[model samples]
Target: MKNLLYLVLFLLAFSACNRKASDASYSWASDLHQRLLTDFCLTEAQVKDYIRRYLPDVTDEQMRQWEESGALECMMLDGEKRYFRNAGPNLFRIDSLCREVKLAKEGEQVSTSDRANAENLPEILAATDGRGDSCLAAPKRMRVTYTLTVDTNAVPAGEVVRCWLPYPRTDIPRQQDVKLIATSEPSYTLTSEGTTHSTLYMEKRAVSGEPTVFSETFEYTSYGEWHDIRPSDVLPYDTTTELYRRYTSERDRHIVFSPRLRQLADNLTEGEDNPYLKACRIFRWVNDHFPWASAREYSTIDNIPEYVLDNRHGDCGQVTLLFVTLCRIAGIPAHFQSGFMMQPRAWNLHDWAEVYFEGIGWVPVDQSFGLAPYAEKAGKPYFYLGGIDSWRMVVNQDYGMPLVPEKKYPRSETVDFQRGEVEWTGGNLYFTEWGYHMDIEYLNY
Candidate 1:
């Protein structure tokens, strides 16, 4: 009887262990749920108050109507309703009525520097007019200090905290003259040039009541590139080449081609046989169809492009991915490129795409910038289609790439790597537990 009882208890224990193993595989799902809640933390009352700033006469019924029409996004959590963190500001950008009201209240104002920047594209096109395959010009040099700080008590005192901050890539043509000036820590490990997501790794022991900070100062030169691509001049891609096969092929997660994606690709590139023209059609479609809006955390999103298609809106990275996926589906070789857009006085994290033309090689395409209104008026409607400005810092040549000194815990940001990552013996420190800041100083032009 005793032997039989022991066998039964052992079997039950084995089953419990197996269940835990199965649950461990889906740990990300649990983490994602928490992230979603953080993103959608705004309460319904808070959102209403926010909208009232622009639409002073907004009524409860109207708010309901907007929510029902999907003009405003919300989710039910913890048995109570919650709205997206940016739902209020995004309302002015997304909804037609709100946009008009906001525009009326605050007239459309473009800064003088921004206007001049827009006007510079034509100059670049003219300067690089006869230079075949030599698109780089107008180099701007700048120094940048990037810092990441983990809140006090994020991890227990005396525990070691590891950090990975964005470092400029030395291999790119447009970005050059890379030099690391200094770092907060005396000892640091800078990843090799080959790392897809270039990073500078450092560590410090957490203090009892103080934030753990990591920083680096560096300088690099960025050049404006304008590819005078003539659709007729583009040669047929050597489909058998490794470059053609690799970029044109489907990637996992964000770049997958689903049934709807395939149909959308065909519809966008319906009659185009030329790869450049096909890419143009797809790019125009995404820019026209999906307007930019504030986005949720990327780590919570499983498939980015599909989310954009469903929501009818996306931020910079989201729209770029949609454009990339569509281009790949249309048999064009496209890849992801991202970093910071370092336009003076207006620097922020940004993402864009790169497409390969058979003989022309790869050219930059910023879907978010799209066709600037001024550029359109200047007869340079597709300026961003094959041109980029000098105000950029290319840190990551590709997205979702691994960091050096491999992280033991899952990254706070799994998709993008602009903001540095932090982890300790306890676990990963998410955006809520830490913060990042970047300061740019223009060295020369």
Candidate 2:
């Protein structure tokens, strides 16, 4: 049984680490464990009661048998035994294993229906019908609402607070018809073109016991694009150009190229001369080999490409970095783009890559979404390679760029800027201290 397997592994780890299974470890762990769970809208008492119902089988005496089992790794922090976040839904699962753990008291699964996907079928059919380059609505019209709110009373009263919200740039071809609906409170200024990340900058005087909020409602066109890419039509960009050199070169820790990554890129594109063909090969290789897994905090990893190469798994951002780095090494002009993936049910923070070719300038590719599992079903296997679907909110043009009106304290998240950021004369407000919300509505026009 899977439970028995975890028990054995935990026993081995316990013995190797020489851990203590005393009540002191689990007791403090119980308190801090539920303390963090409150963020999920569950109270300490409710969590304890849930444990009683869900894990009636686990007992203090039995846990002592393999007390060092990894359910909750207990250690002495400041002379008190505490447990770290473990691999279970609630704190009880490590000691008492359960394949399914429900968050609320009710066992029902809450779900949402997806909005209908707008298609370019008419265009695709038109292109094939007339023998023209395959096309779709290059970009369709969309209206979006993005907001960032810092918790009330988070900073001292009257201190100058600064914040930046990701703003879509009309400069990108796939994005156009940019308009600002409104900005909350004291006015905002868009980040200058010179800044790497495209964001709206705003500041306000902290009001005593009042939440600081910033919001923008805007409309733009997003396209479901597909280029009928032909090897012969695809010409390489001149290597001498600064744009080509800049994109092909590495930037920051996430996009670095080490010997292993360089060699991996070499292997992935072996026997491939066509840039388009080479990109597809590397894209397929990374997708199939790396799979997908929940990632640890991004800040913890030193180099994303090296990490994926070594670990064989990563989330969207992590995998995108790997795919981007490998593509650049293969002599393709690949770069980063991240914002929100606006699904009908719910939008989420997401990242993807874009590469430039001669005939076609910039094309979007989502490595995590990968080649469609059954491309024939949609008549598109190289779909993501040359184009992307219509549902996307592109905010940050590049990652790891400095913020306009930089912060005095360390940024809570240093990697990608999806959720807005906040700071005051006192200090920076981490995600924990603030919250963000995004909503999108389509305009018929």
Candidate 3:
């Protein structure tokens, strides 16, 4: 009887373990949710009050229903109620909740673009040269500088502050003539460590009460490139090769495949055979489908691709990641390349993917830009698939890879690396604690 009981208990435990593995529910989700309730709780009244104060149209009845259903939870950070753009996770039918509450409350669709498309876009298209096989355009080269600064008063006094500022990638072909002109603190600067993402490291000790600043001034010539690719010319890469196998496989947390995703891919590419054609189909579907919305921090979301599909709206990183995942699912190689994008008189951090065509090499694909109202013209629609504007400042070749020195605390942005990361002996500094600035001057060589 004792032996039989032991076998039963062991079998039950094994089944539970298998169940978790089968579903691919992140182990961290439950714990993070619990923290939301226990450590980060805001009382029901507090939530209602906040809504009344900021969102006057939201009703007591509607708010009450959402709370009772566990679809809404107020996030508290540093003893203050912090607002995240979306409800972290819906305990019920999240997709439905988003459509009714989030979208309905807004009264219109999400913002696709706040500005016109690049003014020089016509020139880019005009510059394209069909060199026998593919279209190639050379973006005018310019020297540019980037700077990132942090406030000393934000962090506690007497602790040492270390920062990792993103440096322009030298490995890629487009940018060249790299130069490091200066740093705020000259004595403690480090550069060019061998890592997938390049960084210019700098550090300074907090002086009783003073701001800490870090900056890197560099010049690199920029070029725009596109290869006119045909499906027949894109020969299949050797999938058995280790590099192909690694990139083609699922990545942790953000890039997993599920039944829903597979079904969506299958539905989109029902009759498509060529990988490039399949990619084009998925790209068009995503661009037409999703709109841009303020997103919850990447740390709070699990599967970005699935999240985009569920919400029907996502920011640049979210949409680009979705495109990349779908392409990989179709057996085409794709990865992330992102940093800052510069337009005349404007600059903002951005994310986009690069797809590998056997004959054409890796090509840029910005579904967010391609889908925007501005790029909806002849030839411009397909420009991002292979041709990216020279305005792009490519910093990362891939996402979720570690920094050269490694981070002591969980990163400020867990999914993508940008801006920079900072920390001291006490703990990791949040984005609320510091700010960064970049000054770009167009230089003629």
Candidate 1 residues 1-445, lDDT tens each? 9999999999999967875665465477677788889999998889989988887788889888878756688888878888999989888877777889999999997865466567566667666762475688778899999999999889889988999999988988899999999999999999887778889999999999999999999999988898767789689888998988899888878999999999999998888799989988988888887877899888888899998887778999999999999988888999999998888777888999899998788899999988778668757778788888788888787788678989877898898898889987556788999999999889874
Weakest 10 consecutive residues of candidate 3 by summed lDDT: 86-95
For residue 11, what is the lDDT in candidate 2?
92
Score each candidate by Cα lDDT.
0.86, 0.68, 0.69
Would you estimate the TM-scores of all the predictions? 0.91, 0.73, 0.76
- Model 1: number of clashes? 0
Screening candidate 3 with a backbone cut-off below 3 angstroms (N, C-alpha, C), the clashing residue pairs are 135-228, 139-224, 152-211
Displacement of residue 393 (Cα, Å) in model 1 is: 0.6
User: Which run of 10 residues does model 2 get worst, by summed lDDT?
Assistant: 110-119
Error of 2 at 356 (Å): 2.0
lDDT of 2 by residue, 131-240 (tens): 13344463557777888888888877887778888887667666667888877854778876546677888888878989887888888776566676788877967999
Better of 2 and 3 by TM-score: 3
**Highest lDDT against the true fold, candidate:** 1
Highest-TM-score candidate: 1
Candidate 1 regions exceeding 4 Å error are: 1-26, 111-113, 119-123
